[model samples]
Target: MAKSPIVFAMANPNPEIRPEQCDGLAAVMATGRSDYPNQINNVLAFPGIFRGALDAHATDITEGMKLAAAIAIAESVSDADLKPEFVVPSVFDRTIVERVAPAVAAAAIKDGVIRKR
Candidate 1:
């Protein structure tokens, strides 16, 4: 499946679903934190991503840049860093965000996804 914002919204408790959704909806929600172990969210992704793009002096974001942001965020927490209710870093973990964003921005530059950087 394609990775995008839809992944996050699908995990919502009351996903704003219309008729004819799909078969994979349950699978998606099953992998969510409310139901599964390593629950992920855009909140877990975006702040650091945009921060990174800005830090790199980039004019825009890109797919490679977003992938970099996600990986960067995941790397901040080790297996040793995980716990129930703490599998992902807290949103208030400014250090994690601050550190992660620049890495993502660097990825954007390295991927040549940003122009006039």
Candidate 2:
């Protein structure tokens, strides 16, 4: 049986598969818990997203804005720094807000949903 290349067992307080269990089976793994290396926590994005919406005076968060936020988060991790075990940045990384806010705000403005630019 071939193991999965990626596994995002992002259960809340407990994940479906603990990180240790995925040692050689998965190339990448993520969980909702911060104890693991790659934690797929909303805390990494939401604050910046709200900040961007407020900054741009966006009436609503459109798909484009969401995509921009995702892109910003992805870009936050440089290609050279990107690793299978470190797909997403640490939630503690302060750069998330700096990167995501501008990207989301720009997307809102481009999408014509921003009132204040």
**Estimated TM-score per prediction?**
0.60, 0.91
Q: What value of lDDT does candidate 1 attain over all alpha carbons?
A: 0.62
lDDT of 1 by residue, 47-83 (tens): 7887787777777778788887777776777788654
**In model 2, what lDDT does residue 82 have?**
91
The TM-score of candidate 1 is 0.60
Residue 34 lDDT, candidate 1, scale 0-100 = 44
lDDT per residue (tens digit) for residues 4-104 in model 2: 67889988898988888889888898899878888899998898899999999999998998999899998899889999878999999999999999899
RMSD of 1: 7.2
What's the residue-level lDDT of 35 in candidate 1?
A: 47
> Candidate 2: how large is its RMSD?
1.7
